[model samples]
Target chain A: MATYLLLSTLTDEGRKTLKARPERLQEVNKEIEAMGGRVVSQYAVLGLYDFVNVVEAPSNEVIARISVELGSRGTVQITTLPAMSVETFVNAIKGGR
Target chain B: MGFYVVLTKLNSDGVRAIHANPDLVSAVAADIQAMDGKVLEQWAVLGKYDFCALVEAPNDAAIHRMAVEQESRGRARFTVLPAMDMALYVRLMGQSTETTGPHPWQIRWPVQIARRALRNYWIDQHVRAACQPLTVLGRENLDGLARPAIFIANHSSHLDSLVLHSVLPAAHRRFLTFGSAADRFYIKGRKGMTKQGWWNSLAMATFPIRRGAGRATLAHAEWLIDKRWNVAIFPEGTRSTTGKMSTFKAGVAILALAKGVPVVPVFLEGLREIRPKGTRDVAPGPVTALIGAPIRFAPATSVSDATYAMYQAMEALRLRLRAQRRPDGPEEAT
Candidate 1:
């Protein structure tokens, strides 16, 4: 599984939707799980970005699909960044992988 | 000198810049200080925004300049919301700070003398007019009673005060002061005593008793007791709209127990029919004031026990009054 950081910002319509039905957020998380992704940690942030989610998916393709599926709903804009542990990165740098 | 809640959202470039030099966070705080604003609290929170900052500045224009200066850097968007202290906000919304209690002058001799004059020439006539054919029972109960006692009664009407005053022994009437509702009688948060309040203080010998004031209301009453004056209180706190006796508040028990004074139960009957709660028109009906024997508590008696004893005494008097009931009058058939 690959780790990824998901940054999300709500659109005007998205804010209205969330304000009306906040439970839709948890529902979206369930949908992500159904698409073979696991949300590890998430925060409802205060600034330009509405959410910061750390997730695990089978591969980059699955994460990309998850982002596209969520963004297509017009409620949120998603930015996914693949993450590697420092240990893994250091090992790869040392030609140990 | 004003507070502002500054919501900041870091863009991609800003995040990269901060990642390169985390000291930029403290540097921004320093910048705010240089601009004559103090950053009271800053938190990197997880939610709709990246950071929330509470800042204090001289005024709105000063904070506006501070926000513009920070936003001009293109690092983050600043949403500055003006904030006011909750207490100041409530005060601005017409919250008052009036002290409503028994006035010091009410207990003075001059006021007492004036109150006696008002009661004799004006109030007694009004009471007699309002409660026609008023029957007072057990005046002999107070014949040899001690001074500085608490008169506890069951309240059902506004005329209760008038009737109670009319029936109190003439010797004690000059020294008797009644505990009246502060909210109803006193102007809240006013700078000076109101004219009506002065009239009540001089004429009715009434003092302000705030609801749920607990021991605070007892302070003036205790002072009056120490001065060898009687304090009459409706333990029910307010007139009962149901024409039934409401449960007595325990402040009377605390006052009586603390001062070691006798609790004299005076039950006023049929005043509700004359002028009950929330009505102005008087029916000019027959009313009875039954002054029972003074109740003295043992030194070791609990407050609840003393309160219950006072209530029971009043209840017993009420039952006795009911037993002697006739269509014409409440006078016993002796």
Candidate 2:
């Protein structure tokens, strides 16, 4: 299966938020799970961004939908990318394409 | 339970024969199972060995015995690896790597004077100065103790050790040694400051314990205690990642009982806020430490009974520390 990288950032509203509020992030995780995506890791940082999440999804469109749902929550901004494995890179190089 | 990774190499003839003989494969598996180990995985890989197997057994000796049995079967030479879990691996990584220079506490004769001054200035200007509201309780409990004792405290924050060490009187501090993990802190080739921190700890009489090798490490600890220096140990073995108490390892009780030393119970509050587990960042906050009366082990008490008594004493001390609350008050050293 193709792996899509899903990255999400907390919105200003979420940045000022306390962890005691579970509903906001819980809703986002549920949407990603429903789309057959898995969160590989998540980190709370002390910089320009509040939190960073690394997720694996089946396809770009699935990741886009997940990001849209997260953005609509008004608590985070999202970025998604199609991630390629080293095996795929090796195969492409050997394929002469 | 012990986790063992078994590496085996088969002669080309034996490999060909095993491929042709299902009975041979079953026989090998049966022999391993007979040694009281459960095979978790068997993998054929492109390496020197024909196959690798992961097994769980009662202990290291059982795993070693199984490896010997497998090799004697004349199919393959075998080697075993005792697996240290990932959590332990990460902790060891943190402890072994020295990211900075020799700590201010570890310096030569001439530089030692400057190091001590710098340490005092840093503690006074940074730690003590930054935190406006700090309180110390239970000082009398420590001063009242007349005999050599073991101070056991909950492992909450990294600052827990520093706070305890700082607040202790010079005489007591001279006699007291803190216990740290040997695999991490005391190892050579670590980074500068990390090495320094470990050196400082050693200067303060901190001894190192090798984790996971419980029985062997505990015996070493008993020997250290018998040397008659007052020692401080966080019985939980490791810092509590969560803000709750963890199960204390039996090493402390084993050492205390063998040496017949009194165990002094201590509790530190607000240290988690100052320096949370798994982080290098420090937060300014009010912190308090409470030292409870030392509990003596009865001469006739068995090791198990003394262990139970020690646990009870520590629990009671924790309760007292948690109960004390001063919303608006001056910081007092107890």
Candidate 3:
């Protein structure tokens, strides 16, 4: 199984209005963990948005489900991007496309 | 300053999640520090997220900005929380501090002497008035209780102590003093009845009990009792705002057993609904007091054993009082 990084942004609703609810964040974390995805790290920021959470899952599909779960809360918009290790990056660059 | 932690993970592709990007995390941390927030610690974790960063800011807003900056970087998410000092929290919630506010009895006092005179007069009058209405169930039990005793009671409202004070004979009242917290009552900048309560208590020979001072405060209480002043302790340590009795602390039991004083149990009812906790307003209501037969302390008992026994006896008395008040239904009793 391959590990995938899950990056998410709190929507405007989440950042400005729903940020006060610590229970919501707890619930989100619990849900992700129950689904076999690991929350490797999490941060609550204040610049452009409210929070940022880092997650690790087995596949892109798991990341997609995490994103949908966040979106369904209607508190924040989420965007997920797949990441690669330095070794994979080196190999891909060496393969010439 | 505010503290924060960031958790994130790396994806299958070379691109990192918003929470996991090293550059973004560093920039966000720098931004927070530049804005007067202090970054305490940042580390990578294996479980929930890729990394966790702890930062401290001047205010909540600054921390919020830091969280936002990290999010826009598209790496990870975060949760921020405010931390409280345990000592401060315990002190604020302890029984001694609970009574430092303006009580229903304080409105009549112009100064310390006036407060004492008024309290004496009111207790006498109220005790006389309550004699016919208030049922005396355990007086036979208290008869001949000559030794210095620790009077333990279920606190409901401001009137619990007042009513107890009224019922005790003038001699017992003279030797007896109730515990009140210094921080709440004697603090330098307090206003209104709280300050007045402190002064009135001092004038009435009520000594200050520092909350959460632990064994030291307990030692002071022992000294006062050993000096033969009957000390009335609210073992629940604070009044119950919900009208239901809270769990009693072991300090009362410890003091009682240590001093070899009889633990006199008193149950007060209908006081919470009358004045409620943390308020000065009094709503007219009939209040009742049931003084349990005093339990004697044996010399063989250790402080720990005595503390447990005290709690058991108190809990039994509380249950008895609850049963009396709600003889027919469980719903009426707390």
Candidate 4:
């Protein structure tokens, strides 16, 4: 599985849903797992985005689906990015494969 | 000089600080200029990214320093992107010291060929020395191999492919193609593969392919095979997180069937413990490659059956190796 970084912000409707049903976060996690992507970690950050999610998925297509499925609920707008590992980065610059 | 862009976002305190000091934006621009790059444009946007700044720097390093220094202050976080002129980019990619391109017919200088030869020789020697206790169990079995073929092996550690490439016979090793993830390895192109550019590309013999379906990479592999080059693939798709094998994907089977080539089953052991998935540490250990005989299916054989047979061969090899392994061998080097 490849690692992905998801920067997400809750929309007005999503913020309301999350405010009312805090338990729904776990349900979303389950849904993400069901869609073949696992949330490695999540954080509420102070920045342009409200939430930061580290996810692992079988393929790029699978992760894109997870992002769309989660965003379609209108609770949160998710932005998924394929995260490059330190090893790959170093390898790219190191000139040795 | 290089063009750069930064997408910046301010925190609540940053917003409050900005209100307190309306000159904060100008201060940011000055900071960018101080870093040897001039801010060309600035915009406040309403979205995930708050502010977008365009700058032209003397070099990429200047931009990197600017971004790092800005983030270190904790007022804002920036996503940095470097932009290059299309003409300059094409010139840089095309203007090799010795000419080379996607096609091999391109002429290269003798110095370029010599440099690559030297690099390959060094790599061969380096791997041989680095893997001191490496035992390739099936060398004799692979000695008789004469034609181009595909080698399917387990993926656990990052070192698997390197070690495999290092241990292969010269004929098999020469011009061998590895199916690397296109997204990771081909991020930008030749430079994306490695900083050394053309040299690294030739040394690694990496052919970038898409992750899921075999459409893009499969065709690349087939092309390489047609040119009398062998290809290596990890049919388990991704590396085994737990070091246990996963179901073989049909991509390998399809490639073998389409090319009408034999599929060689290779089993790697001990490398995972040395350097497993999701890790950067490299522990020294004895790694072994148990090579099995090639599995060739008849023309009428189904892809699924061929895949299953390949999987079964690898499984049986693992079992046999386990049965023969000693309980107390060379302990894993810490």
Question: lDDT: which candidate is best?
Answer: 1
> What's the count of clashing pairs in each model shown?
14, 9, 55, 0
**Cα TM-score per model:** 0.53, 0.53, 0.50, 0.52
Q: Which scores greater on DockQ, model 3 or model 4?
A: 3
Q: Which runs of model 1 end up more than 4 angstroms from their true locations?
A: A1-97, B1-99, B120-122, B189-195, B327-334
lDDT of 3 by residue, B302-332 (tens): 7667766666776776677666775453344
Residue pairs clashing in model 2 are B98-B190, B98-B191, B100-B192, B100-B193, B101-B192, B101-B193, B103-B196, B136-B334, B139-B334
lDDT of each: 0.77, 0.62, 0.60, 0.69
* lDDT tens digits, residue span A1-97, model 3: 3444344555667654443443456567788888778876555544433445557788778778877876897777765545544334344444653
Candidate number with the higher TM-score (3 or 4): 4
lDDT for model 1: 0.77
1 against 2, candidate with superior DockQ: 2
lDDT of 1 by residue, B201-270 (tens): 7778888888886787678888989998999899988777555566677898899888899988999888
TM-score of the second chain, each candidate in turn, equals 0.67, 0.61, 0.60, 0.61
TM-score, candidate 1, first chain:
0.92
Chain B fold agreement for model 4, TM-score: 0.61
Q: State the lDDT of candidate 2 residue by residue for B107-172, as single tens digits.
A: 234443543555555344555743546677777877766446788887777667667767666666
DockQ of all candidate complexes: 0.02, 0.02, 0.03, 0.01
For model 4, how does the per-residue alpha-carbon lDDT over B74-122 read when each residue is reduced to its tens digit?
8888877665433223233333323222223212345336535765464
Off by over 4 Å in 2: A1-97, B1-126, B129-131, B196-198, B201-203, B218-224, B326-334
